[model samples]
Target: MPSPNYFKPSHPPTIANVPELTPYYYDNSIRMSPMERAFFTKIAKKDKSGMVGGSDEAQFFRLLMHATGAKKALEVGVFRGSTTAYLAQGVGDGGKVIGLDITKDYLDEVDAEEFWAEMGVADRIEIRVGNAVDGMRKIYEDENGSGTFDFIFIDANKDDYDAYYEWALKLVKPGTGLIAVDNTLFHGAVLDKNHEEGRAIDTLNKKIHADERVESSMLCISDGVSILRKK
Candidate 1:
């Protein structure tokens, strides 16, 4: 069973009172490629775990990559590679995306490599399956200490957020890289004291706010996305 505070609002009461979405907003704001649309449909049909982020979140990630001119990216949780596809699209043919997941089942289930090839980005992504912390370390070492990525997306296990943040800081470019973390709000469970996953997220949120190395903001976008730009 879930805790009572699982769905409680973390935002102020006034803000929480606002409608979740409006027709005007939905009609005018979102955009997706045909490939992206297909990916969404595929996930809807196959992904029963509900691990994928909404289209808005995926689009935001792509926008951030384009806005930053991110040529090299790292995605901590590849899930079904939906976000990876978006990242690849944002970076173009010359860029690359390094994806890490704890298991290969999701990647295989989604036929990620085949999809990337179909999208004309197979050469741009390298999928690694194992402990993300170890993978990040290997990546740092393999790049000869200079493979700093321009953008990073973290959406892995909530308990490892702090550890991931530490590695993300090390892997990202010192001044311009962006690190975006998904599920910081955890379905508003962050308000609950007893939820371990929520507590993990809440801890990372506080840490990011206090950390002087980055400028940060938490948006109410799908499940909440916390974006940090390194100083």
Candidate 2:
């Protein structure tokens, strides 16, 4: 009863075809737009670290922008500008995303400028290459030391997360701005208390939990994203 094509070497089945990868997730997941898929594919091929956020996570960022009506956003880490692109889309026309990365090597490798141009959001993105803290500080100072950002995302080095949070608190709008910290779970290492990176995140988590200036939630999305809304 086998068909002639039964043993044929066809293209690999993805979530669109094989819903069995994670039945519940695949069944209910929101599908990526064509542009999003292309960007994701490009990053998957170029990024050796495999650290890019998943489509779901990227969608969450976009949703956050839409929900908050955020026009000005900042991303502390700009690895290949994958999430940066989503953030740019979330901000919409006339909005801006300030991306800070330690190096432009990854961005250059991925032809980020060309891709962003192709997506029609190149003008909305501003890339600053330098030490994260220094870059953030410069942004903070350039704006005359006031909280001006509607949203700020932190995904840089774990050791500097606390410092990044400190600056984020200073840069985001008061009483309404949102701050998102990625990798808060540190791959469940925070639970085991065995990893140095995990310990650092745990420390920051406790600090954020205790801080009264923001209402926070630890969303169990990709790698655990902790979102804080300034009060």
Give me the displacement of residue 172 in model 2, in angstroms: 0.3
What are the lDDT scores of the predictions, listed in order? 0.84, 0.85
Model 2 CA deviation exceeding 4 Å by range: 1-23
Summarize candidate 2's per-residue lDDT along 128-187 as a digit string, tens digits: 889999988988887664688988999989999999999999999988789999998777
For model 1, the local distance difference test gives 0.84
Reference-based lDDT, residue 53, model 1: 75
Off-target runs (Cα >4 Å) in candidate 1 are: 1-15, 20-24, 145-147
TM-score of 1: 0.88
lDDT tens per residue, model 1, 1-231: 544644754654433566654455556777766876777778778845577876788888888888878899999988888888888887887998889999879878877778778888889898889999889888778765343789899999899999999989888898888999999889988989899999999999988989998999988887799999888
